[model samples]
Target: MKKTILAAMMFLLVIVPALSEETITVKGSDTMVILAQRWAEKYMQAHKDVVIQVTGGGSGTGISALINGTTDICNASRPMKPSERDKLKARYGSRGVEIKAAMDGLSVYVNESSPVTELSLQQLKGIYTGKITNWSEVGGPNARIILYGRENNSGTYVYFKDNVLEGEDYVSSMQSLPGTAAVVNAVARDKNGIGYGGAAYGKGIRELKMKKDAASPAYPPTLENIRSGDYPVSRFLYLYVRNRPTGTLKEYIDWVLGDDGQKVVTEVGYFPIR
Candidate 1:
């Protein structure tokens, strides 16, 4: 009887803390990971009892986690596909809730030293689709153009393919990286290399001024350009939940959409939804 009481005490000690603490798991978008971490850190500092865990594989990975009930939030650079929505409805009895967390002008990156400063939409599609393989073809030097891109499971990858490539496949020779940071690092080091990712990630690299076509004026991914629809590659960044948030989750989501959280979005180099 004494041993049974001891077992019961041990069980309470182990399970009570687990039940008392609240944890929010955010996973997905490599593009949004830095911003999400910042939000989590700031949120936790104010509410120490609530723990927020953030992870990045890719946007697609995060959506998969949401569908599978493995994560509380999925950060995605692109809107959820129709098939993903269907899966959420099948499991949760509702289409997943989407929160617009930020805006990003999907930027094209090149080494700062490269002279290729701007690209038209057609030129970009041609370069990425392998029809234009040399820098000289686009008015740069004689070097062969090297392409860096995100992997298949990335929402950035899907967005770029659908928007820039117009549903065409990427060039077979393009080097696929795991995340935007990797692509930025590659472009920073490789003078002839070009890559595409969130404008927020353009630190050591150059974010090209993009034109709708050769006939249009070129513009960088500035806030004004994006807001005015002058930036050709701008997109909304998102957080998707299995259902409409409630309890602690709803409170957290509300905070994120509030002023303080939107400020963090700009601080991390992405535009706010507002």
Candidate 2:
């Protein structure tokens, strides 16, 4: 009888732990926060024991946290930079694993009330750099462009600067918001405001048309354009994890990659990589 009881207790011990897993800490790009939150919510449904703490401090903040071992995942809308890779390698013995979770066709949005409808990449560059302040300079009414942007630490900001702005500087007049949602709100109300963010945030806001040059008219960003690489500012959203993820970490990562979890990605405004 004692042997039987001992065996049953052992089985229960194993099952209890499998049933209740602790929370996984994930932090990173504001652009991916909405989708990540959705994943976290759904992930918790089957995994009543699993909790995911999702936070946005921008990609840089998330990377920093990852290096410090404070987070299990670093979410990003852009690929890891060399310096950041080096830092992760130094701390974790190798650069953390990069998992491309979804795709985003970024949009430059403005107040719907604004007359401006299109802007070539060059015109956008000029506008953001303070070289061309008036909307009329880019096919709109005579009004100063109120530039809204994600802070320098944001992956969206870095991606935009590297691609569309061609490494140009943001104008001093630009207001740095905390996240993409904030940028959307700012542009939705401010007629003179123009901001760039992930396409997921494009719903209530009007997307600015983008052109490569005078030869191509500005086109609205779309999923097809992003997947085909025609959307100039499209980017991949990723999750960076420590090398050889162990324990629940591995399972959580696997869950996110699975079809059920990835479905949430599309629903939340991102193109699932799967």
Candidate 3:
């Protein structure tokens, strides 16, 4: 009778784990959506019982999702505002907070064939704001500068305007793309067009040197400069979660900061903060 009861108890233990919760969700940061998707794919391989869902709309979308308790994590390409912090505090307490995930040098790019190589921060501001309408104004041939910029929803656009343009509005005639890669592709095809994005996405195009504080850094973007902080436009990437995360959400985030997860970040284009 004792042996039979013990055998029955072992049978229940085997079924409990199989029936436990088996899925996880993460959302945020349109800028990192591509990389996030790639990470999700690999994670789900060994963790077949755990499913990870990722989506990209914009940083605001991600933050809002976190506040509403609609997502496990909120990815952002920009730092949070004081007001945003207050909102999260209201909802989840001060302990609910933000994490730095990686670093990126925002890159200004033009068509590869563009004759111009380097540009000053002041020149970049003028060009983006329509003050310098002609390429010749900055030493290029006599051609109207075709501004291709990210939409207002993008964190990159907001950062550029606030940091480089001193909160100036973009030129009225600028073409706004939906995402970073879109801007890169658009500028690559138009000899007169110029756009900006994360340094990781600036391949096959020429980065416009942003001269800061009279310092002569490299003429364009390079991984080395980005890591060492010589690149002025560089900034940290973020992920916001409750200060004390729980469950699978915590597991996933902890993994991202670990060495193995950082390797994935390096493989995908962004610089690993590790």
- Which is the leading candidate under TM-score? 1
lDDT of 1 by residue, 1-274 (tens): 9999999998888877668779999999998999999999999998866899999998989999999999999999999989989998999998999999899999999999999999999999999999999999998999999999999988899999999999998999999999899999999999999999988789988999999999999999999999899999999999999888998899899999999999999999999888
Q: Which 10-residue span in candidate 1 carries the lowest summed lDDT?
A: 12-21
Worst 10 residues of 3 by lDDT: 213-222
lDDT string for model 3 (182-240, tens) is 99999989999999988768889988876675456544555677777677788788888
TM-score of each: 0.93, 0.90, 0.88
Q: Which candidate, 2 or 3, has the higher lDDT?
A: 2
Give lDDT per model, in order.
0.94, 0.86, 0.81
Runs of candidate 3 with Cα error greater than 4 angstroms are 1-21, 213-215
- The global Cα lDDT (0 to 1) of model 2 is 0.86
Clashing pairs counted in every model: 0, 0, 2
Candidate with best lDDT: 1
Please, what are the lDDT tens digits per residue for candidate 2 over residues 1-274?
9999999999888877886669799999999998888989998888888889999989989989999999989998888889989998887789889998888888899999887787888888898888998988778888888999999999999998888778878888899999899999999999889998988888887897777886785666777777876666677899998787888888888888999878888888778775
TM-score result, candidate 3: 0.88
